[model samples]
Target: MEKFKSFLKRKDIEISAKRYLIDALGAMAQGLFCSLLIGTIINTFGTQFKIPFLTSPVAVIGGTEYTAGGIASAMSGPAMSIAIGYALKCPPLVLFSLTAAGFAANALGGAGGPLAVLFIAVISAELGKAVSKETRIDILVTPLVTVMAGILLSWLIAPPLGKAAMSVGSLIMWATELQPLLMGILVAVLTGMALTLPISSAAICAALGLTGLAGGAAVAGCCAQMVGFAVMSFKENKWGGLVSQGIGTSMLQMGNIIK
Candidate 1:
């Protein structure tokens, strides 16, 4: 218990921020491969079975493909932001402000609008630090306040932005015929990359119009990535039994190929 507490204490905000940034970039690159993998799997299986999966919930909400990845990516960021804010002893209002800023920045950045998420994240984190007095009560209230603020802000701003992103997606799609092979390659590569990040493969599949096949491929890719990671970990440490054990469990759960 003491060792666990010490480990938790070692998780600094600066380190968290850096890790999140790396994850963001990795997610973007991996999104492309995920799309390709999903596309390929769908193409192969869709021929034999009628799969009824949707690529991402974001696509359902945004009414556009381009925003799918962003939406999926946003799902994890908020929770992480809230946790980080709490850890750093950010005030309730400040935590919410930071969340809002990060949400907006990520939303805008994913849609190719601007490179503002980093700046927003930094400012929000600093502001949170200033306002929070390092109290347990503050940590408890931070997520709630942040969530409310984020919801209000997103409600006001997301609609128009979503529409614009949809328009951009349409333009891109219209410019070329959607090719299955290309999509497959892109999805595979992206999925491989995203495995290291905190992004969703479902969103990438949606972006590529592989909604029906996303779920299956995602499960498979996740399983494959976990296996790969386990192998690598084992190679580094001869006593890495835990990694192999986890891989075995994940494989058992995700091995079934749909169709």
Candidate 2:
């Protein structure tokens, strides 16, 4: 028992914040940039903005014209998992294992898919990592354990978490509608902060099915963070900085801003 206790107290199991940032958040960012940001930009500018020939749907698949956003949305699940696995420092074999986990978690989570993938992927990675070097056939062992853990956890936990996330979003949306001035302020501040944080406000909004006042408020908040920072830092960064920070991502300077 004492030996087990000592083993439990070892630092190897302890996941530090820096590690989390490097592994988890970093992965999320990559996924978001590739799937969400790039996709959104392509969809929005191409479909909505009038830029002569450029403003047309990028491609046609399955009798449907697909904009950048549409393609990105479809690929979000796998992209998120792949980037996340890379960040988690997963071996090549285990990296693909996380991809399987990501699909299950995202699918089961419904609207709040990314968040579900986030939780499941991180846990599964750790579990897989623990047994990674234990077996001679690491290729077989790591992926089997990781994918199984991820799928099981997704089945057991994702539905409830997704529902909870949706519920919270609904409450906020309703509140925003009922009391635009008050709830708007609250949602704007909170969701805006969420946009800048490591999480995905778009996924949350979609999960919550937020629209009308709440959706508007969410957009406002995100714009405030993105454009606000870009404009504010214009003096220091110049036009290039404005384009990068504003159009590219306000979170670019998150660490520096925090400091």
Top candidate, metric TM-score: 2
Query: Candidate 1, which segments miss by more than 4 Å at Cα?
Result: 1-78, 86-122, 133-183, 206-220, 234-259
- Candidate 2 lDDT at 151 equals 95
Compose the digit string of candidate 1's lDDT tens values, residues 1-259: 8875564454333445434444433332233223333344444454446443423332544454523334443343443444444444555566565555555644644442122333344445544443354567876555444445445444455444544444434433432334655544444444544443333333433575634343344455556666755555565444543343233222211212110
* Global local distance difference test of model 1: 0.43
| lDDT score at residue 55, model 1, on the 0-100 scale | 34
What TM-score does prediction 1 earn? Answer: 0.38
- In the range 32-76, model 2's lDDT, one tens digit per residue, is 667767777776686577654445567899888766577786677
**Model 1, position 172: C-alpha lDDT score:** 31
Model 2, residue 125: C-alpha shift (Å): 1.1
- After superposing candidate 2 on the true structure, give the runs of residues whose Cα lies further than 4 Å from its correct spot: 1-14, 21-23, 49-68, 177-180, 197-200, 203-215, 229-245, 248-259
